[model samples]
Target: MVDYSILQKKYLVGTYVNRGLTFIAGEGVHLKDATGAAYLDLMSNYGVAIFGHGHPAVVERLTDQVRTLTTLHGSFANDRRAEAARRLTVRCGGGLARVFFSNSGSEANEAALKFAVLATGRRRFVACRRGYHGKTLGALSATDGRKFREAFEPLIWDVVFVPYGDIGALEAAVDDATAGFIVEPILGEGGIIVPETGYLKLASEICRARGALLLVDEVQTGAGRTGPFLASESEGIAYDILTLGKGLAGGIPFGATLVSRDVGERIPRSSHTSTFGGNPLAAAGVLAALDLLDEPMADHVRKVGAYFMAGLEAIGSGEIAAVRGRGLMIGVEVRSRRDDILKKLQDEKILAIPAAENVVRFLPPYVIRESHIDDALAKLAGILSGLSAGSPPPCAAS
Candidate 1:
């Protein structure tokens, strides 16, 4: 047998902390490693596999499209692309009239920022502290994280950062020159921090009163991850722009920026275009995702998510500082040894990811059942109990 990890370390850029496991197959919410070990996936590849891996609908649609026509420039209209865009816009209806397709979430936020500048004719923007937009230059400017931004100094245009969930700070940050304010409905990468109730609605009002556009970054919280098509929808706010990615295309590389009619009109022709922006393959995946991510599936996510959160809270371990999130996007804020806990979970045939400094974030697939949650909670309880009893973690030294 070949050791893929050694080859990857030698050839690929060392950007990611490899978990030393190679997944060869995935079905439903379970992933099988090269050695045929089954592992329950709670991270969902950072919230991408909403329908779980190799969902029948997504596989069937993608299979048909791949055989037909895969790649086509955005300048040409394709049947699948047109249908996908129409359905997506209608589903996100809050005066949203258009969508600009891209390859990733970072590109979606980048386009939204540029469109905001064009629509409002201002280069300044506002963002929230602990908010994660993306790593691209334009998006990074609005992402308030010193770790990601410190290396790339003097990023894009003028961007002001303010405390999240604080209406006063957000309102004070926006002024005459502020074109827009970008924020995540839930801070996924920043540790699954959910904002206060009506925070988005109040921010929308502030942006409108100040002649600035509101851009809701739903990249992590969208596509049924948070028990809603868009997390901002629950807030009853009509934002000027909304960004979506991750599982919007059922594991394909896809991003979309939905804009209001007014904001859409401000974007001129040829201002932005992508070669594989609206590829037929990705469009088919989007259609499949839209069909499966119905109201019933969303309700399932809510019910199962609440049950999972309650289970975690019931553990009542001293190592856990808090358990917070909405829908399936949960975070277990550990007082310390977050990485050690993640490693232990891996050892127990489960996979999870870390966020911020001390959060064991769980972006489980919507298809995750109560039994899966129970299994994960059981393992977590054992790990936390061991930690609380002064037992050294399995991978503490590493």
Candidate 2:
């Protein structure tokens, strides 16, 4: 067996409690560890691997772009960056006509915040409780997790946290003095809690009425993860500022905050920028990702998502609490043994993520096959049956 414990102990940051699987390679929707053991990738690298690992289209574009131009500051114009911005705006399918590129979801959100301040001239912004934007100072201020934000108190003074899905609370929070309201259409990292249909529309109306902008953070739920180009688009809501990441480059680091033409006209050019933002290599990958995500693949995700949800429901027993989420983003709530169940699933060669509400999150890549879903269900059923009988999960790590 390949030994990695010493390397992990020496170099890895201990902030994240890893699952102990050292993936050495991947193709399509499956990953192989150093020991050659295989696992079906259901977590999708926390929703980054939208098209799965090592997709041919993305790989080819990245290879070609590296030879041509890999790193350049955003000051100069590049063909790939221009094409990527055009493709993104065309896909947005609304009045959103301008794009600001960044390297990660956090930076994308930070750009949106800066745009909000520039457009509204207000310092205050509002976000929902338990909503996660990102970890940067500005984005972290917008995120609502106490555990993540507690250490950094005094984030941004004007930032406010309100109950998600509560129109009244959102309305009360946003006033004429507010800069913008940032929200996740579907709470992705907060356990796949999709709000009611009109919740977003109502929030947008409130923000507009109060002279504040609405910014939708689709970082985790965008780019076919939710059967649409973006979760906000699926809900039939348009925002003044929209952020996209996670799946933008099919696992490559790429993020964008699109500003409506009206919002774009208000901001100056030098107000915000990133050194590696919209670099040619990442741009080529983004362009290829956009091209590959056509209508047929999106339709497949919708059908397969329904099928997967049904399978999970059919396996439900008293030990299972609830199943929720939309498209391919699913969450399974259990009455007990959440951690133990996750370890058991790992041992059974299935990958899943733990949610804040004791829920198991399944964010499989868009390329996951029907057979993969079936195998995941069967393995999960075996684990659940064993756990329900009061037997401790045998594979749980110390």
**Candidate number of the best TM-score:** 1
lDDT of 2 by residue, 121-177 (tens): 999999988899999999999998878988998897479889888998998899999
The TM-score of candidate 2 is 0.96
Clashes of each: 0, 0
lDDT of each: 0.92, 0.88
Score every model by TM-score: 0.97, 0.96
Q: For residue 317, what is the lDDT in candidate 1? A: 91
Segments of candidate 2 deviating more than 4 angstroms? 391-398
Best by lDDT: 1
